[model samples]
Target chain A: MDNQDEIRKIQLVNQLDQLETISRFLDELAEAWDLSIPFVMKLNLVLEEAFTNIVNYGYQDNETHEIVLVFEKQNERLLVSLIDDAMPYDPTIAPDPDINLSAEERKIGGLGIFFIRKMMDKVSYQRMGSNNVLKMEKVINP
Target chain B: MMNLNFTEVNNYKVVQIEGRIDTITAPDFESGIMNLMSDGVTKMIFDCTKLDYVSSSGLRVFLMAQKNISTNKGMLKVCCLQPSIKEIFDISGFSQIFTIEDSIEYASGS
Candidate 1:
């Protein structure tokens, strides 16, 4: 394969409103890179879930933090790494919601991370210094 | 972005939701459903034909509606889901949780 890749990053404040910014960025990238809409929407879903978790429960204080999203497209693989300076939390450790349970038995929690695992081909988490990095990757289906 | 329209068909309030229902739009969508419930309106059918995308938050609202309808002795049916959204429902086990119909007529019929 060729050794060419495109990398881009977007910095967002620790606010729920930034969800629209993420969607817009992905929309523009998909249009410019000629990526399929469905493929990008999956990426968008995971990104939204990851971002919501960070912005909602990451920090303990009222201080504003910056969340960063790094995207790289190489060949047939698309990878996104979310970096945040919030408390040390690893999303990959969360248990999946039991899909076998009844509606009343199931809790509303855990589905976001579940989606990240289900939609992505690879999901890995790392604690680097003060930042928690969650990297998700998916192979483009041609 | 989301657009919601409500109509009555065969004793069921059919709510047609269009566009993506992500974190940004979920609260609004939830409130819209809440309004219907507060008005003592139950036995509803959710038409998701144009709902191209749904995130975890959106799924939560769906679950809430279902639970509320059950508690009120009413029924909540979801119909006309796009394949992509259906895959989400399947993965989340929502397909078994709610009554899913291929058409709004079928959803309202029962």
Candidate 2:
């Protein structure tokens, strides 16, 4: 965590429309770091899934809320931390969807979390005060 | 943001999708494809050559469409998936569920 290692953070409103903005911000960060297209795409997918879950189910009220994302590059791994005050939820504990099941019998609710786990090297969740804190790490193979 | 374009080729409905299909655009993607079911479209090919990305939400939409088409005794084929997008499908086990081909012609033939 060098002071000059380009730590980027963004606060997005809890709305589906903000997905595009989040993607742009991440793309900029990835570009600045010279990350490969495949790596950036995978990171983008992981972030989208997590953010979508928070926007769709995190808050119970009709008002707007802020979801924060922090990104950093550490040695051979990329680290991303998400902080939201919407609810108390731990996606890491969710059961992995049975990928072996046929398409007709497969369930859709859990694939988002399951994909995140499969794409990232490590995923950790914590409750800090009133916010749900999630951290994910992915090793840069290239 | 996502864009879907459809064309008819030899009695097969070919759909070319572009841009990202995340949670924000998946519902529209689902309904757009499902609407074709009403037209009695039995043979379909999805060309993903221009598709930039697909998340879990997108996968759900594809799965739903495949199931619906199967129920109607139709065949759904996907072709020209970019490497990364194909990787997502492979990781999700969707590669086993759908007929994925290398090109539009091959998909149409199948």
Candidate 3:
């Protein structure tokens, strides 16, 4: 049998508590795909940043919105995409925090997006119809 | 699952955090820092030996505590971070902004 690329997916609502579910999902993927704990955590941090951004500021209504995460192992590359129906947001273009700034000069709010960009090897965002898709990738063992 | 244990060493209020600090638990972490600041406990040491993971949410709390402590002329130092967590601190430029020590004793100057 040809070794086909493996794919796993989890659906979460735009809520902070779902981060635990996301962590479990990533942990399960690590166990199945033989990913390192540190690598799993890197992905975890990236997803948490993106997920928190959506939950806190993506939507303006009280209604619940669904966010789907698709994880795929494409040979040596690991890829994950976040799909949400919230307002159009592009995390990749957000200005990075001034890392050189002292504590007094730093701002608390922008570091979430900055962590996402710094942790992932490649990050891209696209507004597909009504959904916001943020794609992230990392090549393993390079 | 996460837990924060507080201990006092000299003038430093050492906060030892265990488990991952993610989106769900960040609020608790924030309140813990806030409570300490309000109590006027100046010198602080964040013992992170058991803290394996931290997202930006958690980092924000760290920054907040630092800002609050510094403004009031108090010291905040983080010690015993796991390498992975330390890398997060490093990449986020947290290493530069916080006084990081290799041991809690060093952090508390005890």
Candidate 4:
């Protein structure tokens, strides 16, 4: 767990259609690792938010961009790292949505990052060599 | 990969959603709900029993539908969410905003 030997990685192009492709990859990972239903669901949720953000707002041009995701299991926790060569954006520091507001008054811009924060136990962001690296971890204990 | 089936039950429009609602399918989902609202169908219940997954985009659609229904003086309820989807709703605090029921009968009645 301390080494990178067990890390699983998937690379994708920055496109909305790639969400399904990445989701299938996660499903395979879940089955291979015997991940619980809730765990897999949460991971998928986080992936969708992070990946969609990169695809929708990360690029200024229409050209395709690369997005890399790495998964690692350490002790009782699962760590996921999403790396993209898009704009330098840190979702960890994004504003939390005001969930206390009524449905009519609620705004939608920040809910994705907010959900990512709420579901994951730990979330860290770093700009590494022109890549926006977002790392998230969740406890996977039964 | 999402399918939305709309049915009328006791004068309430029930939208049964299947498959995953993510960034790609959220626009269609939003427009479908908006179509219902434009058609003057306000009393709605979203049946999420067969919905495998939903991301933040889907939540935004739900919020928009709720707001539209409220402005029209209509009602909106959701029923039969899977455990995982329910957890997302709970985390987003949607459980407090929308009336959620265990069954469509309860949702329609309420």
Best lDDT among the predictions, by candidate number: 1
Q: Assess every candidate by TM-score.
A: 0.95, 0.95, 0.95, 0.94
Candidate 4 lDDT over residue span A1-142, tens digit each: 3466457899889988888888888888877677887788788888898888888888999998889999998867889999899999989778788888888778888888888898899999999999999999998854
Error of 3 at B57 (Å): 1.2
Misplaced by over 4 Å in model 4 are: A1-5
After superposition on all C-alphas, the RMSD of every candidate to the true structure, in Å, is 1.8, 1.6, 1.6, 1.9
lDDT of each: 0.91, 0.88, 0.89, 0.88
Give the C-alpha interface root-mean-square deviation per candidate. Answer: 0.8, 0.9, 1.0, 0.9
Candidate 3, A32-123: lDDT as tens digits: 88899889988888898899889999999999999999988888899899999999999988988888899998887788898888888899
lDDT (Cα, tens digit) per residue for candidate 3, span B1-110: 77999999987888999998887888899998889888888889999999989987788889889888889998999999999998998988889999999998788887
Off by over 4 Å in 2: none
DockQ of candidates 1 onward, in order?
Answer: 0.82, 0.82, 0.83, 0.84
TM-score of chain A of each: 0.93, 0.94, 0.94, 0.93
lDDT, candidate 1, B1-103, per-residue tens: 9999999999999999999899989999999999999999978999999998999999999999998899899999999998878989999999999899999
Instruction: Tell me the RMSD of model 4 versus the true structure.
Output: 1.9
| Interface RMSD, model 2, angstroms | 0.9
Model 2 lDDT per residue over A1-142, tens place: 4667668888888988888888788778877887888888888898888998998889999998988999888777789999999889999999888888887897777888888899999999999999999999998764
Give the 10-residue window scoring lowest on summed lDDT in candidate 1 chain B.
Answer: B101-110
